[model samples]
Target: MATTTHSAARSGGVRLHVQRFGTFLSNMVLPNIGAFIAWGLITALFIETGWITTIGKALGYTGGYGFVEDLGAWGSGSEGTGIVGPMITYLLPLLIGYTGGRMMYNDNLRGGVVGAIATMGAIAGASVPMFLGAMIMGPLGGWSMKKLDALWSHKIRPGFEMLVNNFSAGIWGGFLAVIGFVLAGPLVEAFSTLASKVVNTLVDNGLLPLTSIFIEPAKILFLNNAINQGILTPLGTTEAAQAGQSILFLLEANPGPGLGLLLAFALFGRGAAKASAPGAILIQFVGGIHEIYFPYVLAKPKLIAAVILGGMAGVATNVVFGSGLRSPASPGSIIAVWAASPPGALVGVTASVLVAAGVTFLVAAFLLKLDKSNDDGDLTAATAAMEANKGKKSSVAGTLVGSGAARGNGPIHSIVFACDAGMGSSAMGASVLRKKVHGAGFTDVTVVNKAISSLTDTYDLVVTHEDLTQRAEQRTGSARHVSVNNFMDSPRYDEIVELLQQTNGAAGANGAAAVDGAAVGIPGGRSSGGGDLLSRDSIVLDGRASGRDAAITEAGELLVAAGAVDGSYVPAMHERETSVSTYMGNLLAIPHGTNEAKPAIRRSAISFVRYPQGIDWNGKEVKFVIGVAGAGDDHLKLLGKIAEVFTDSAQVARLEAARTPADVQAVLGAMQPA
Candidate 1:
């Protein structure tokens, strides 16, 4: 009978694990669809509107325009366009964050607030330490909120009314969001201004040549006529023709800056420097996506100083000369700048480009040399430590026990060792059993050490010490429980080996075998069917002795001892207690594992801790404690069970007043399973 029960439990666990994997995959992929749609809509709106053309004209372009024709005006267009684009992008992140938070934390308001905070952090974090800042802050903010919620709101709160009223807890979530944006805004503006100043200072020093090369001609073609005259100058009827003529003149200017930018990249860029340089030159010289140089800037930020210095010098030289162009530079070429700007403007643009390039080159070379010299500072010890740690982490096995698998006595393919605390003896026992099993020639079998409460209806067989057998049995109804205090002292090891041999013999004879048996008893005085299992005994003590806190603590420890939870679980419980009391509508408190350490173990057990006096739980007095543990995909099912039982006002009243361990068990036994 025991063998049958164990086999059935193992099969159920395997199914549960597969279902969990499916749910996880769904969560990862489904949310992104909404974000993609939102981005697409914003992009389409930009393409449809004429805002791009108007902004380009305002920025000093003279050619006929349409939305799609002007790429530069997309990001930094008019105030209206700028506002819309960013707002659209912002909505997607906010939605994803809020939805994800609510689902994970079980508090909608807090989740939404956390999501908003994360968005704010991401925005601010993007500016300072560069893109990495955004990546770190977003995830960190989310993680912090999750821990906070788990620690406080779910563990400490007493009643349903109190837990619901504690929604105000989310208000604190906005604090980080506010701080991140405030600090990031000023820093980004400062960096932009500093970048501009660096260019000006280098030009003033005259160490770089003042000859318009790249940007000069592009500036003359685009900025001179439209921004300087068409848009900035009076636009009355009398000035219309002059505006057109000015536009034509700027268009015809020399494209010196375009050439200079190309030359700078060709000379300095590391990868495919020569090839990329000409390509960059051709693109800037004709297509005009100034952002093309951004990658180069990232590869070597110090190069920016030189680029700016060279640009300033080249612009100054072009200004001092009497070079100019008559029309806007369409293809930012030297010919275009000559055609667009008058002689003086042309020379100024040329001079600025040459100066910026030279400054950029020198700064880049110096920085590279300095970096090489400092490369050997302190990395050797760090690398060795990291490699050693990596080896350990990799050696740890993944969760190999699948759900819905039968436990058989046949050559065991897998062994799941469980105990109450998941620490101490259970772990040691598992290691010993695994070695013995290996010695029996079943080398391919996998052995896992876990807390008893975490034992699901999965695994070929579950080997546990005596203390945890009942809890394991209650949790995974069909799992075959092999109660062993010590593998070395017990005859169960030989029994297991004989069972395997018998199954193999059966297979050889009839092509079918009884692979596994139900819960097997050792040939010892102490058996799983012993009469020592605790029964109901009504005893009322000072509520303090058996209060919610005491019960939860004791139950948690028992679970840990049984290998149902980890020893570190107390901290996780405390953290949950801090957020709110987990005690819900009735006498039940659903305490879950908050950290990554015990996320896969989940079991429901009742600890009848009687208190002589009740302890203050939020505003209510509490006596009994019911400890709930569930993790991974079982979270929802566990929560559903709590919700169904506690939602009944009558059921809660009886549970709170229950007197003994058996009485506590009776209350749970009477409740309908969700």
Candidate 2:
């Protein structure tokens, strides 16, 4: 279940770690796929050995004007003149470098300019187009600028900040450009040369079909863009320039396997998967959105074998017929694949796709028929798992009815404002939201700002700039993450405020009359029991722990002895910890049950335990452990007091010095009656 959500626990698996790295590499190029398509179109129709050049000569269109020959960049009249060579050589690599830089800097445009400037050196130094160099320099330039800025971020005077920033970026870019020219260009060029040699070796030895064993599984894991743009596109573009077409483009972009799998599900699958397969087929095959079928394969895990075999057959057929495409076929649509096929290779390309589709359909149909159990794979759970891999919800996943797509498990009472640096934009956003929240008479809701790296699972809602939203979600898996472009004003803020108002209104309507919260065990909401939140007996002065798990268990025991929660809720506390770290900075750690464990609460209570040895908690030191159990909203007040005390380092220091349970209670300013 920990793997089902984005968290530190999820990163424990080696496959998911590789998947995330691949996804990052692909994200830099996926945004600029349109430029690649445009370049492909021009190269296919107008190159010297392309479709137009072959036809124009027979039709006698190549006249004294030299239009056909010029367009094709041949006949010694035009050598480096056509849009094909320059676009592939210059435009594509620059775009990739710029996008990579922006990503590393958290969407700051200054980072992009610096990165592009640095990438120019690598491009000039390399003999080829420098696509690989661009990938290296772009992110490097952006990250360098970020670290440089952090050194003196707030040190500049108010009016001179912009001037310093602009000059600093220019100077830093010039320095990196020199470095990239001297180092990165040759290293990346040599690597790209090696890659080309490897691909040629595989093709010559008839071992190219074996690539499907890795490619098919990677595509299912949503690493298709990484394998295509980050690797195959650059290599294929170079091959196409020398030869008329390259078979590398057809490896991952072959849509036949996905089409066949969906067709099989449409025929033999049960329930929503069967009904959705027909609609998904149109989206996956014609629309060129291969991801539309990933849920189907993931749901039935056995279907992977079918796609792998089908992909192998397609590659083998293409290799045998000497078939290849002029450029990458993105989205892996049947139409794009056909359109990108070389004029002379149409028949062979057609045969390859048909054969792959036929093999996959037969294999998938057999697997579905063999399943005799009433139970089948659940599409909803699979889609959720897919989104977990994606790090965010997919718009395509919504077309399926049973996906259960929702953010955050409980009410949005605690909202966090995060940014690249917590001091600037996030602070402003939190201030604006706090104003709106208090203005609407919902003063109980808490809004605060923090650095992106400092985010914790204690927050129910987290707001960050659009570029930083993915980072925020990676840190706090269960939090409902919201991305807003502007800190001063955003429409999303209004939507959030409205949602809270409507939710509160619904709650008010549901229980118009007075009710007893203590008797019924009010779950995950505020109840009206205002008793003493802490007592002397609830404080433990001599408890010690060796690790995070042991410390959390001890905290849960204190709550259970205080008669705040049931014994079953102890495991729930561990669940919450695994989802995200509960270590609140300032030598403090809060251990509490998950939102689902709210029913186990008998009443609202708070407990404190002091660790003399200071436990090691996920690389952080913790000397104080606070246990929380809230019946309704009563526990929030106690939590708020602790939060306030921790903000002042002096008060925290005083609390840490206390030796007895009574002294600890006095430091907290909460001395409960006996």
Candidate 3:
């Protein structure tokens, strides 16, 4: 990976902190998905749709059904709120409190119990459901109890531990419960009333469509997760409890924009993109993967206008019909939106989506027409010009230029596209990169998509949108991190390929220094210059190693071929594998002989093998195997230096991507032991 730096101005003030708090609240609810689904299903089937009433009538036992027939209230949405109503009213607060507490206390039950008990007070005597109240009291109770437990643990007698724990919890729970009822309840109710008024005002005035203006742009910027999950979902859940539906849920959950964009591409796009667009339509509408179409809009930046117009059309149609959803449409899939819509609102929702798609198609057609000629040209050159223009605007571009030199002599072997959930844009980004890499004839390279939370040091490069750059950097320490503004754009892919080529070229050259002025070349001492430790004949550019044992034997024979070790070294390597596999992560492994097999070493030497297909080292992937042969601490020192080199994911990436023995040797030769 090439060395490039990016800096984003961190927004400050109360608004930023409030957004962070909203993010924290959303994160707490995310882990308790089972609970939300239960609530949503119960509310959707029994209470809102009155499916229970229909079932009762079918069974010929109906009081609710009798009222429906007599009063002509078949779709009144009044099933007396049902069992699920109380569940949302009473049980939901406890669940939120318990989950929030568990989150605060590292998922312990102690905090959960306290949080659940404390939140009951907030719901006491409250006319409406106290979801927001629970959000506050639950975490607070858990945190307070945690602090109290820590204090008592230090002071309490060992024999009285159990007794003290129960009594302390009882006392704290009692006090917090009172505070929740007296102080938190009224405050939360007042805030809820205020928010309801604001929403109602918008709905009444027919100005609710204005929200799409901000929503569409934010969603394109990949703020969809934060906006939908963090802000709207929470608010929608509360509203759904009262109204039996919520337009807030439909705001960001509408997939019309993405669907429209893909429809246009499927009909009008050229080349592979045109072919892929047809498949994307099914994935977006039926499979509920709205992110499948993000790349299409990203290919031509002007298509964002189409997306915005489509989103607004959907929102306006939803508002005009007074259509709302029973729950948030997760994945923003059309099916999910339909399932969540109120009874009799499905027609309106479907029509809105179709209208939005049609409008987007017209707008996208115009945009594509404008760029049709340039679409087949060198996209990389255009991207390069765009990047150079950005550099000119940066305040630190001059300073960055000095540090923007190529890094380690490694090519990118593995690239991981990471996002918040890893399902949406990140997956598409990986697909885009995979196509580009294969087109470049780098078949050995692998590209995978993952959630930011699961990222590790094993990958050579991490590709993330600008919003996630900081988190990606923190997760993948030494791996090269690339930040792009849009995941769907082609230019970023071209830039990555160019960087890989530059690093590959630098690897073959001797005595080169990277951006940090770190010496990167063949590891030296007496090895390459005079000693038998390093030899050109000892390295295999592409080995036919099938498995762990085979890869080690192949590497050991390189030493045998060079006459640096005896036959005993082969079994020694096997014995070492038996005790503990030598697979060091980052797709590289060190197959060294056992410490007791020191006598088998004729002279300190190292042999390298690059497995293009990658060997299954035990259960781990092994792309590079460096067999060690040294006496005393010589091999240990060599192993340490090799660890230093391979640890830079960029270097390993280069080695894995290298096609020839000379290319592989150049990368290995550039390693400077730390």
User: Which one wins on TM-score?
Assistant: 2
Per-candidate RMSD vs. true structure?
A: 20.2, 13.8, 16.8
Q: Estimate the TM-score for candidate 3.
A: 0.53
- For candidate 2, write residues 332-427 as lDDT tens digits: 888998888877788888888988888999999999889653223578778877776665566688666443534464566788888653433454
- After superposition, candidate 3 runs with Cα above 4 Å error: 1-8, 11-22, 52-81, 270-275, 295-299, 373-674
lDDT of 3 at 666: 63
TM accuracy, model 1: 0.33
TM-score between model 2 and native: 0.66
lDDT (0 to 1) per candidate: 0.42, 0.74, 0.66
Query: Which ten residues in a row are the worst by lDDT in model 1?
Result: 393-402
> Distance from true position, residue 24, model 1, in Å?
18
TM-score of each candidate structure, all chains considered together: 0.33, 0.66, 0.53
Q: Write the per-residue lDDT of candidate 3 for residues 1-674, one digit (tens) a residue.
A: 12222222232233345445556686666666556666676565555245555566567873544433323221235433245656667876778878787667545567788888788888894666777788888898888887786553423432454578788878888788899899888888888888888988998998787788888765544456667766677678788777777888878778777787877776777755566667668777787766556545545777888988888888788787777787777766787777777655677888788877888888987777666653423322333333232221212111212223323235677888886544334544565565555455555567777778788767888898765676777566547888775443447788887776765442323222211111223344244323545566777877866667667778888888888778777766754554334554567776766555667777778788888887776677778888777643333334444544564668778877877666755665665432
Candidate numbers sorted by TM-score from highest down: 2, 3, 1
Displacement of residue 186 (Cα, Å) in model 2 is 3.0
| Candidate 2 residue pairs in clash (backbone atoms < 3 Å) | 525-632, 526-632, 526-633, 527-632, 527-633
The clash count of every prediction, one per candidate, is 143, 5, 8
Q: Is 1 or 2 the stronger prediction by TM-score?
A: 2
Per-residue error for 424 in candidate 3, Å, reads 36
* Among all candidates shown, the one with the greatest lDDT: 2
